[model samples]
Target: MNTTPPRVLTIAGSDSGGGAGLQADLRTLFACGVHGMTAVTAVTVQNSLGVTGFVEMAPEVVAAQILAVATDIGVGAAKTGMLASAGIIEAVADACDQVGIGRTGTTPFVVDPVAASMHGDQLLTDLALEAVRGLLFPRATLVTPNLDEVRLLTGIDVVDRAGQREAARALHDLGPEWVLVKGGHMWADPECLDLLFDGSEFVELPGPRYDTKHTHGSGDTLASAICSRLARGEGVVEAVRFGKEFVVRSVRASYALGAGVGPVSPLWRLEG
Candidate 1:
């Protein structure tokens, strides 16, 4: 059997708290047994409490990082997280297009529309939302978005199961081959339910809703895990299933770090 690990790339911001952003992506990739690479789009001064400030990198710098990785180490799959600006989003989309990402390209790509934090701090601008939907969504093997992001991208406020279906179709219209509407913010039900749409059928992934607030990096972790599975050649549906299972385990084993919420440890399975 071939023993070489798959290589996956993450284009995102840096969270100083080590609980989210690139730090979380790298940790999740490592736990999923993939070699992780990165292209920092911004540096955020954030912690368990909240974000104070952030500075986005120049579009050229972000493009250079992606190009450098694509041309040299190469990537089996890639994921995009917190792109802070329209210019950065366009740049990343362009670079990924050149390097070939998603169904129309050589590599599979996961797009996590990370527009806000768990604590509701805005990480992406209002104007950049259009860029994300237009440039990145079409190139994504799967696009993961929470309720707020769903409304932001598709103009549909999803509250129930029917609303979720509507939101998924709206997002599909924007271009992603598949869409996973995250249910972490669904307060109506005690059980967590994620809806996955592939433009035809909907797959409902249900799990026990944990009553904890220490889910700082859950989104990043889930997206990166999906990317890692795809890097290892798993199909999109299988990748999403594995990602949800992995996140449930991680969230179950989460512990407090700071005064506020802590991150879900990607290596939780190894801890036991």
Candidate 2:
């Protein structure tokens, strides 16, 4: 019996509230039966309400952390979130190349373009945003961005399916092999339809639109779930579909936490 599980690394920030960032990534990875590792990029003082402040890790330190785990334990897949600066983004890109963890590498890379908190607090600067577009996008195996991020990255305001396709094409032009335009922010839509495009074809993943405000870590959860499935050796489409189902169930099982919004629960995996 093989006791070792597939390993997935998260190059991200820490959410003091434990509702998002690498905290949520680890939870989702564990729930999906993958071993999770981390390269902390930033540490934020935040809760369900919003992010009050943050301190970013030095670029070299971030790179060292990635090299450390990836060289010794090995990574099956990896994902990124809340890289706070251009230097950090550049460092992450270079380290990812060194460790063979991106589009041209051995491991799959999931870029969860987390620009802001659910409460609309900015987590990344404009320069870092540019770096993510130029440096990380080309190296990403999959770039997963919600509507707001889509608007920020591609200047496309995706309000409907047509707009989603347009935004996906624009993001694809940035060089990721796959682009998942998450529609969770499309409040007017009856069903939450996440669009996936791989240059030539498109896959629409539709799910029930749950009436809940406790969706703080929803994006991180979905992206990490996809990374987990990829680490388990699933193909991109299959992995994304699995991720969709996983997040839907998580949101369905979501419960209130702090004074404001709560996190989407991966606890559904533990249910009998």
lDDT of 1 by residue, 153-202 (tens): 77788888889889989999889899999888878978789999999999
Clashes (candidate 2): 0
What are the Cα lDDT values of the candidates?
A: 0.89, 0.93
lDDT of 2 by residue, 201-232 (tens): 99999999998998989999999999998998
**Range of the 10 consecutive residues with the lowest summed lDDT in candidate 1:** 116-125
TM-score each candidate.
0.96, 0.98
TM-score of 2: 0.98
Best by lDDT: 2
